[model samples]
Target: MENIVLRRVIPSDNSCLFNAVGYVMEHDKQKASELRQVIAAAVASDLEKYSEAFLGKPNEEYCAWILDSEKWGGAIELSILADYYSREIGAYDIQTTRCDLYGQVTPMEGAPEEFDQTIFPVLQDRTIGTVIEGCALKLVEEAQRKRSYTDTANFTLRCGVCQTGLKGQKEAVEHARATGHVNFQEYS
Candidate 1:
């Protein structure tokens, strides 16, 4: 098997899914806000297609919620993004070593002629978690073959300044803010 290398995009806030999509597109997390706008517009334009069943709420309400920076992205948004971009999206659950494809169900009109793939991490909670493109699926497959795949959800965060450890990102971020400790590293 060819060596497959992947890059990780850490979430700085609740917009991690948007950030991951932006990262896959532009390799920059800052562009997530723009991606969010694009997604919201796309979702708004096709409310009938993206109904309450897919959104878990009325289309308009879901669009508004998605536009909120505090709101996180999920599978429905991933499907929309894949359609909007006209590319195949691979959502990988690191915990389960499972990958699902979005936007390849039906033929897309005016899609690029070349086959393109984008990979995004799906967190344990089923939320669109992180972005990892460029041979990410190959890397995952290789890890699975080697029995070395580890779930990031079980990783612990350690404060760089005080060596304080936390179980999750939420707690780690809170710890950093409360104690003004800016540096943290994840340990499994």
Candidate 2:
């Protein structure tokens, strides 16, 4: 028999990613605030690694931006959290039907030190890619190419900051640049 993987649903708040990770690691769903703080501290402590060039914004700006409770977190936050907890994270993107993996591997149960230090990351990365490539992800991706997925280019969006309605990613980006209001919600 195969092990059934069950998902523990998290809230739909902006901090859902943090809450989900917290729940999985420590059985706590309300750790978003704390997790945000952790990411801020981690990024601040290592400006060299999390520089403006890498983060697409000033390090201080990113730190401050991420601390906002309404700001949504992404790969950067998950990578920081994974490092902080010393655990590999695999985030499932329901929209894409994909799992984005993060963090440093700590070796298998009985692996040699040399292999663990040098080859594990590469191996795991390839294995995950191979698995996804061999699975139904191809079908989902094909459907997406066939126009089965939502046209994010023209989806309805509303600025959560000022109750301003907008259309699609282009308007959303413009709104954020103009008003510095990054929080948004999709509307039908």
Candidate 3:
């Protein structure tokens, strides 16, 4: 297996980031809309909080990751936990029809031709679930590090279907059910 490149997200990556999201949404409609709304709200409400928590933090500490293969495979956002990721969060969950109509189709519009240039690799290889696993691991690692007397990280993600502990966002969606664990559908 080749080495994977993981790093923090930047402000310049907005378009490409949405492209990746669009790519994932191709699988499901309702779920996709819910995720987009969640992420958009999080980004809009307190962007500075996300930037500091996900970008300013150290790798495997508090930041999210975009896993990319050295040769093929594009990047995916993982470990999307933030102070504002709540199920009761208020935001307009866009519909799939709106997403498609708005040109948020597969292969990611406004992305580069090359795999590296595109948001999530021009060529899709790994499943979205795999990307989620990487994200969960990163979150767990960060929570472990941030464990303090007053603050502690929580590993509360459960498989939406099986109810077992899910490794990533894709898995949670793929296995959409009452998986016992409370899942926060953010960033499809």
Candidate 4:
């Protein structure tokens, strides 16, 4: 089989999503700034399509916000990038094994062609892709058996902002809503 290997590492910064996507598509992390500019330009090119109601802010404001390197990106940014690249972008949640796909929708005429430049947890060329998949599943199963994943529903969390204790995800959200605190730490 062809040598399938894991993609390059992405820094776990606020701009990780941008960096990850750029690395997968272009094998470059410096593209984060350019990707942000791409998103801003996409929004600017279509104000009605990316309206205030659609984006939860004025187009100009949203464009400016996306250009800020400290800002975290979300669905709108992903969707714009997907359209710009004409490729289906998938974000996988490791703990949940959930994959969210962008650019899967049929595009209007004159849109760019669709292709896949993706990420993977590829095992080195020891055996095959199925073997790699099986290894991953086995690893996940072992982790589950060990209870290595955090139980967000029943775990103890502390609010980093106010030092308030929270019992679970619900409580954490409540604490954030009450005091505008967003950072939480999990502890036993």
Candidate 5:
């Protein structure tokens, strides 16, 4: 298997990442060309707004990793919200990082150890399912530990085919539903 690079999202990566997402989403064979343009604009806008914070120490409590796929194959974003409040949803005073995005699934278990240490971060190759499970557990633990987080955490996991809902209480429930395991089950 070919090893892929995993690196922090950088300025130069803007178009590549956007296009890769477009490529993945394009399998639908719809108006992917136009969709790609929209994605590019959104990514560029994000870069303009957060590029400095991304590189600085404060870290914006947010970070995105790009799969080293020559272009950008997969990406994930994590964010730590400090003073988050939502009235319609009825939540407040939470310090939790949202698992913003989990890019196309990457099977990490069978990956060469050399690549693990050399190329990807622990989270880089995590399957969308794995990332969702891990994030859910972390969110549950964080809320329990703090107690001030008098609210709930909700998450969505986008596998290659389906989008599923996961809650703090239903960790295993979600995994069992991921019936099609491409990269993960084989390696395990």
Candidate 6:
């Protein structure tokens, strides 16, 4: 197995999504404001293309709001950023084990070829983290491997009635009390 580990970049405040994008792009956190400005400008420059579905407001108003430092970036902003940078953006929810992809703009026939860059979003609560597709798969695999070992190693009790596993004596007793299943044996 590869010893690849994902690096985390915590946001200074509510601009976590923007900061994560900046980190993935090899930019300093301080540059997040600038990145936001760039995205806003791109949206402003092509109001018709963005439309209400993407911006969720009048093009001008959305542009202004997005440029504000206090504003949080969401799917709309991420989609715009993806197009502006010609990269794919992925958001991962670790607890739910889900990942959503954004920014799949079709290339303009005559435009320059887009780079295969991936941007990740780290959720505010730190319960979720995102990375490129390849890295994300690695993370999922590692998590599953660790989970299998943890499940087997930590479970100390088994209910004889249902053959259900329990983590400890307390859980075993509780299960028996709640389910009226008195028979249990500790697994060796």
lDDT string, candidate 4, 1-188, tens digits? 23222223467566888987786677566688899999999999998899999999999999998998867787888888888887767654456644463111112333332322343333576354455444445545554666655566799999887788899878987887888888877777
lDDT of each: 0.64, 0.70, 0.32, 0.68, 0.33, 0.62
Give candidate 6's total backbone clashes. 0
Better of 1 and 2 by TM-score: 2
Number of backbone-clashing residue pairs for each candidate, in the order shown: 0, 0, 7, 0, 1, 0
Clashing pairs in 6: none
> If both were scored by lDDT, which would come out higher, candidate 3 or candidate 5?
5
Q: How close is candidate 1 to the true structure, as a TM-score?
A: 0.54
- Candidate 1, clashing residue pairs? none
Model 5 Cα lDDT, one tens digit per residue, 66-120 = 2222222222211211111110111112255443232222235355323332111
Error (Å) of candidate 1 at residue 22 is 1.3
Q: What TM-score goes with each of the models?
A: 0.54, 0.66, 0.18, 0.58, 0.21, 0.52
Alpha-carbon runs more than 4 Å astray in model 1: 1-3, 101-138, 141-188
lDDT of 1 by residue, 90-139 (tens): 66665455787421111233333232233444569653332233345656
User: Could you tell me which residue pairs clash in candidate 4?
Assistant: none
Alpha-carbon deviation at 43 in model 5, angstroms: 15
TM-score of 6: 0.52
Assess candidate 5 and give its lDDT: 0.33
The candidate that achieves the highest lDDT relative to the unseen native structure:
2
Compared with the true structure, what per-residue lDDT tens digits does model 6 show for residues 1-188?
A: 12233434355465877877765565444666888888888888887797877667888888888877766677777786777677767765443446674221212323321322234345686443333355566665565555522232356878888999888656866887799996766676
Cα RMSD for candidate 5?
Answer: 21.3
